[model samples]
Target: MDPGGRVNIFVDTFAWFTDPAHYTGSNAVQVRVFEHLELSALAVLIAAAIALPIGLYLGHTGRLAFIALNVANVGRALPSLALLAFALPIAFSLGLGLGFWPTLISLIPLALPPIMTNAYVGIRGVDRDVIEAARGMGLSEPGILRTVEAPLALPLILSGLRTASVNVVATATLGALVAGGGLGRYIVDGLALQEYDRLFAGALLVATLAILVEVAFGRFEARAVSPGLRSPADAL
Candidate 1:
């Protein structure tokens, strides 16, 4: 588009944001924002629950490492839209209906890979000598994981959550396409109505939210990880 067109779009987006009509009732921007965050948070939490244990077990026991690797690969390969499409039917069969369940279910896969991979890699990558030393000190297997390996691996484990959180937040926009609510409603509706401002505003909102989540996670990682335990890159 021309520069003039771009400028006009920005101006119109500003107008859309300022319009009071967009802030009330069920389709309000705040409501949509809440919906977006709620869906994204639920997806990430669920994914972490399912992936972390398996990754931790595999990483700790040094068995079935292939599962983590394969799961990560498959999750990365699966398209979010395709997963949403695949989930729609399953959701209906289970009487879960539309909006939340289908969208939330689809997003879980998008979050799984990073979390699982990080948890496994983080735990598995812990210095073997440290583990041996813990054992030498008479720590049991569970004690070693809880006290020794997990603490050292916490940064990377948290890194996976960071990645998953951002991914879920951004991709949650797709939920709007499946009769779900979120900032994406603006984009989908805008395109259909030929309202470029709404489309741009929606895109901008999603981007802003994603960036904020990333920054929040970054701060959290800094505080959560011990200065001594942080990787060299992190330390810098």
Candidate 2:
């Protein structure tokens, strides 16, 4: 409300993080952090698995161009909280119970768009001249994709992974709203009990995790890009 109150929340958040009591139990900060990572990782992995193949195949063949481009748009059109809310009823009717499944399902969409779109765009963005060169060298369709296109597309594909990872990490906070675990628990419970420090601490943790993922992926993408493709089409 006031400047003093905001300052107090900051001070209290620092204290909350330093308190040993928050680090040793089932509900410890480390435990919640792990759960948060676990949920985010699984959702991203699943989304990638589903999106990558489809995106790559469509991009390689240059087929279904409309679907490839539009699917991500559709996913983005849906809100994360709305998706989570929509998932709850179906999860119950399917006997999946609460917590993990619904949250996981909702997070998958949050991750899907960037990954699928990037994969599609990256592959399509690969120099057509390169693809023709691969074909001229007697490389088959799969070989062209594996040896030429995918390698060239690596930086962008990894960019997608980076985006998806950060997104999932940030949005997985919604899991707590559905009785799931994670740092989000701190946010939800803190707000419920009017413990502003815990709320701030949770928000800080989510932001930190998201930033770490962004940095890690950025470095990995740099090292992971194909060396020859590092230059412009002039070399091609």
Local distance difference test values of all predictions, in order: 0.91, 0.90
Clashing pairs in 2: none
Model 2 over residues 74-126: C-alpha lDDT tens digits? 88889999999999998899898888889999999888888888888999999
The estimated TM-scores of all candidates read 0.95, 0.95
Give, for candidate 1, the lowest lDDT window spanning 10 residues. 67-76
| Sliding window of 10 residues with minimal summed lDDT for model 2 | 226-235
Error of 1 at 52 (Å): 0.8
The clash numbers for all candidates, in the given order, read 0, 0
- Residue 81 of model 1 has an lDDT of 94
TM-score of candidate 2 on Cα atoms, chains taken together: 0.95
